[model samples]
Target: MEELMFCYQCEQTIGGKGCTKAGNCGKDAEVAALQDLLVYQLKGIGFLGNEILKQGKNIDKEISKFVQDACFSTLTNVNFDPERFVEYLNKSQKIKENLKTLLGNVPANAPECVNYTIPASKDEMLKDAKKAGIMYDQNLDMNIRSLRETLIYGLKGMAAYAHHAHVLGFYDNDVDNFFYKAFASTIDNKLSVDDLFNLIMEFGKVNLKCMELLDKANTQTYGNPVPTPVLITKKKGPFIIVSGHDLKDLHELLIQTEGKGINIYTHGEMLPAHGYPELKRFKHLIGNYGGAWQNQQNEFDNIPGCILMTTNCLQKPRDSYKDRIFTTSIVGWPDVQHIREIDGKKDFTPIINKALELGGFTEDEPEKTILVGFGHNTVLSLADKILDAVKKGQIRHFFLIGGCDGARPGRNYYTEIAQKAPKDTIILTLACGKYRFNKLDFGSIGEFPRLLDVGQCNDSYSAIKIAQGLADALGCGINDLPLSLILSWYEQKAVCILLTLLSLGIKNIYLGPTLPAFISPDVLQVLIDKFNIKPISTADAELKTILG
Candidate 1:
């Protein structure tokens, strides 16, 4: 078979190499090519945006947002509509032209990406896309190519974080500006490996700030998440299952569905929405319905309620429920209904009507509950108690086992690690990755549950804070504390968070189910040598080593 596209940014890419025919996430050749073209154009915009900045000019916030949303849409599983990528390709061209004009004296010798004419039609764009992908540079140094792809993937993740914060009215100029600088650097032929490595390290600190901004945006608007128990059971009557990471979408849905005989339950990352006081206040905002994104196919199969995906982590829908599943924000599928905002607001009346038409579970499922809302605020407030436990020898260690979850084999290493850890150890987790063992009965150690879920993946800030707070309280470096990190990554957001951790000099992280294929052997050795990062082994073996 002829090769169509190449992508290896996610953990589950084919054979731990690159996906060549179609994305493992269900995107086809045409859509894949268009996304490649969109990214190629984004780099061009970044190139010109940086040029404008060099002359002490301010690019409009809208341009920054365009760059942000464009990068985010190209992320794994975010958007698969060929037409949408065509739109993005065209829009990016217009933006690049506008930036070039703003810069005034554009060099005729600028990179081909910066000076190329964009094809107008979808057919033309797809043709161009085939030649615009990362693999096009057959002559580039392998290690350099590795670093460049790493940098771009990390930027994609950071853009996702920034976009989330932006939705909640939070803006950080440094974060936005860094996007231009970083994306522009990906096209630089003169940067050495060390230079790229150093720039990538700086991104860690920047992404930390980005996550902090998102934390503030969420807490200030929704109030601090408190320890709240969310049902894992279904309720009778009409209900809507909200998936992905966008709370504002869920909040708006909650408002629109109230008093309409509909229940709103969270699925996947939206499970954390139940912990927010402002959002949970809506009584119709019932609880969570599913485990993680990977399970949505069977989980939603023939389920009575409609599904609403607000962001990424959307698998190709099954024929049974595809019509009932609606997308909003940047998430897309070929034929699924998409809810776009009208003048900065979305109307969920169609979604509401879908729920009414489908009707929900025929009978109330058996009641089961899991706890959430363990953000930094909640965890920090209990630091004194945690410190007391540690001092008294009641707690032996801390293991942070979380990240993006996927359907690939071998992820159960997380569940085994969580289950086999010493009885005296405390487990801290965040992200949908927690679903691997979240339902297990790991009883508490005095006042704290053995498992502390620190909200969504973005709330990784909370875990960092908790670690830092413990370090300060104990008067030692974060690495000096008795903590180990076991992470399972699936997408770009995980990549950015990993960069943030490595930048902070956090070490000895156990990463699996497989190392990213983009990291060349040379670069992987550098990371291992510098930080002592290790690929995960069997769960029991890793546990014995970690606890030993």
Candidate 2:
């Protein structure tokens, strides 16, 4: 009865407990171990990097970027290539040793992770990785383990946001510094639940700042998203479908593929790209083609054109179309072609050629329209109208049912909740979870769309701004507003967003389809007692409870 790997970070983890034999996301034991070892190596670098910082020494920005992207690579379904993780491990080894040498002499009480080194043999390295995993120390207190894993998961999510922002030439020292603080804390033996809780909340606030930095990077670099309607039909000719959440990649592809006779369709989280004025300006940039990330397998099956996985949420590619899919940035799958950035730019020649060879659809399909580009700017611009509608009793409530989605059963709660919500209520959503009910015709509430797609999960900041704007207009506290947050989480990104919400003192969030297994009973109770975090019940029941 040995465990292959233990991961409870994502909501769809096996049995609502942990993925032991293999990850539900298609990562096997080997990839999981390598990722564990890679994260452990990053910690060594972080520990010494923090020590060097304490001594007023300077570390290269490359090191910071390395940590960010490496941690990101370990996120759910981002990188499944064991060889890529091995390269990361070897790279961090030199960085860690260089930092220790620079420090000259270190404290005797430094944690073992600070001095940890990768094994020469792959077999031995996998064995050692098991020891570095979440359940390595069985004797560790359940509550402490719970909080520690929670913090680690939040950091993973934080690393994702910071990585995307960093790619856009945006950096926050406070956000970067916390990486060291939180990672080094994983080794400290004396921290209590309260200390970890405080750190977790602090991470939430920093993540908020990170989210804002990314928002600026995106909007300032491109343009504030406008209310745009996009076509969802397949058009004739060569085409490329961009997936994941990296806008820069999409921008580059849009630029390169223009006038190349290839239509560009976005998949999954990239559907929001249609709202960015700069991106959508390309006439060849057609509409979105697929639903959420979980549906990519069937959606991309031997289809025309190619897929570019720029950031994360990559599942195992089926053999039917594996050769046509390319990974860039931190996303990698074994044997798939990886596009590398040279001089801060990626060339899309290979993917473009593959897409061209595929020749796309033989003829144009019928077009259907869906509305996007409803960022905070767009929503708040109509503040007067919304307030007037509210005063006239035209709008009853606001439901912010948003977050990542997965293959977990009972996730239809989000769909049913949106369907069951009163017509007078508006269902605001962001991230891929919106795909559940986004296509359904909810009609319009006067000038506003019934379902507001507020960009990606990274744009959760937009949601926050929208909520605070409404609260301000109504002259009431955020919790007092007629808004409910029923979220369905899948990965670490959702984890950090949840932490961000809780840190703002927001309460009564109904989180499902199941709570994280990493949360001990005691820790869960604390969250319930302090924040009133409720597990989601039936959509109808919860809807009735919220209204009546």
Candidate 3:
């Protein structure tokens, strides 16, 4: 039998033993092999890009953008088309060749990764990719392999956020440069485990910077997100459902669909779009339609309008509504209509016309509201009140339950944690993970609501800011405060966030559904010993332990 693809980059990897046949996220062996080949070529690009930077020369701006997009394409559920990977591989080679001409004659025996080449045909590429997987690293130390994989995964997450910010016209030189450095280091066999571990920590610092850049881009482009109650039910009219995390796409869609008699509803991470002042100003930008990305097929089944996917977390559309589903940016599927940007503007008329033809729902559904937009600014505005509540013993503890939501069976722990928390405890959530309990009422503690939605996973920077602010206001270290991080991770983005937390020396984080399969036993022990990170147990049991 032919060797199957090996992918263990996500939380839902098959049996926690790597996906030998196909990925759980609908990626087949061919796509997975292409992704691995893409990463290998990206290492070469990073090497050349970094060398050019060291010589005080500026690489093409498009090189940075290409690096960001290529890394993002390799992320879980982002791109599955082998043809796209072939295109990326060809582009990477051209970029590397251009950089090489600029750098005159160099050492003849330079690193092999710096001069990596793509095969002439797709068949040759696949044959070569069979030997170029994550396990291809010939390092004898398992710990070294673990740290290297961790760095690669973290960089992939950073690339996604950076790409979003880049599209919104935000660029950070340090953040972009670090990507090249991280990618190049992954192929450097001379680096010791300790050296690689320090680089891994640096990946966390840069990821935090990337997330901060995205936060700035998001807030500046679309004004700061404010506290707003979003309607959860449908209105009787033509409507379009926008999913994924790209605010710019949603912003464009809202503008194009306005006054066209079409209502726009957000789904998954896009739910937080309703709180931005610029986005919410459009009257037709109605409300959110579904829970999280995991429920897209069921929620969208036989839906009456068009659906636009803007980023990752997109599942294969069911045939029942596949024709109405449209994808943009790096998202693609076999037969769905993909809308691309012409000049600088994206024509959403296709999605709009589809919505108009479908005629949406026959009658207005009953009103249901869920509060969102409690970002760092909004939360800090209430700092005095929150601090006073804590001083007065009204708000006992703060529980931050956030990260990507998944379809795994054990994910209900998040919902149960929200349900069982004491009335005085504040539960702050972000990303689609909050969907598990965002609709459930937790009542208010003093003047502050017991549950606060802090935008998307990118707004994790907001959560970190809130924690630091609270720590400063109380004259204590963040770890010494009455705050606990209970995160449910599902993909590479979550890996970056976890590294950010660990980099800050934050301890006692509760993570589930299970620890990453990528972390070797020794590496896991190191994390446990240094940070006290623990796997989640039953909600009641974990709550008792945390409260005590």
Q: Highest lDDT: which candidate?
A: 1
Native-to-model Cα distance after best TM-score fit, residue 493 in candidate 3, in Å: 0.5
What local distance difference test score does each model get? 0.90, 0.89, 0.88
Where does the lowest 10-residue lDDT sum fall in candidate 1? 125-134
- Cα deviation at 152, candidate 2, in Å, is 0.8
Q: Which stretches of candidate 3 lie over 4 Å from their true place?
A: 137-139
On residues 1-548, what C-alpha lDDT tens digit does candidate 1 reach at each position? 76888999898899999999988999888888888888888778888988889999999998899899999998998999887777778888889889988999887767888987787688887777766887887899999989989999999998888999999989999999998898889898989999999999999999999999999999999999999998888888998999989988988888788799998888898888888999989999888888889999999998887999999889989999987999999999988999999999999888889889998888888899998889888898998999999999999999999998999888888999899998899999999789999989899999899999897787888999989999999999999999999999999999999999999999999998899999999999999999999999998888889777
Comparing candidate 1 with candidate 2, which one achieves the higher TM-score?
1
Give the 10-residue window scoring lowest on summed lDDT in candidate 2.
42-51
Q: After aligning candidate 2 to the native by TM-score, how far in Å is the CA of 250 from where it should be?
A: 0.6
| Candidate 1 residue-wise lDDT at 508 | 95
Whole-structure CA lDDT of model 3: 0.88
Q: By lDDT, highest first, what's the ranking? A: 1, 2, 3
lDDT of 1: 0.90
- Residues 1-548, candidate 2: write the lDDT tens digits: 98889888888888889999999988999989988888788777777878878888777777888888888898898999988888888888887887789888977988787888887777888888976798888799999888888888898888888888888899988888888778877777888878999989998999999999989989999899998998888888888889999999999898898788889899888988899889888998888998999998999999988999998889999999999999998999999999998987788899999998888889988889899999999999998899999888889899998898888788898999999898999989999899999899998788877899898898999999999999999899899998999998889999999999999999999998899988899999999999999999899899889999
Candidate 1 matches the true fold with a TM-score of: 0.99
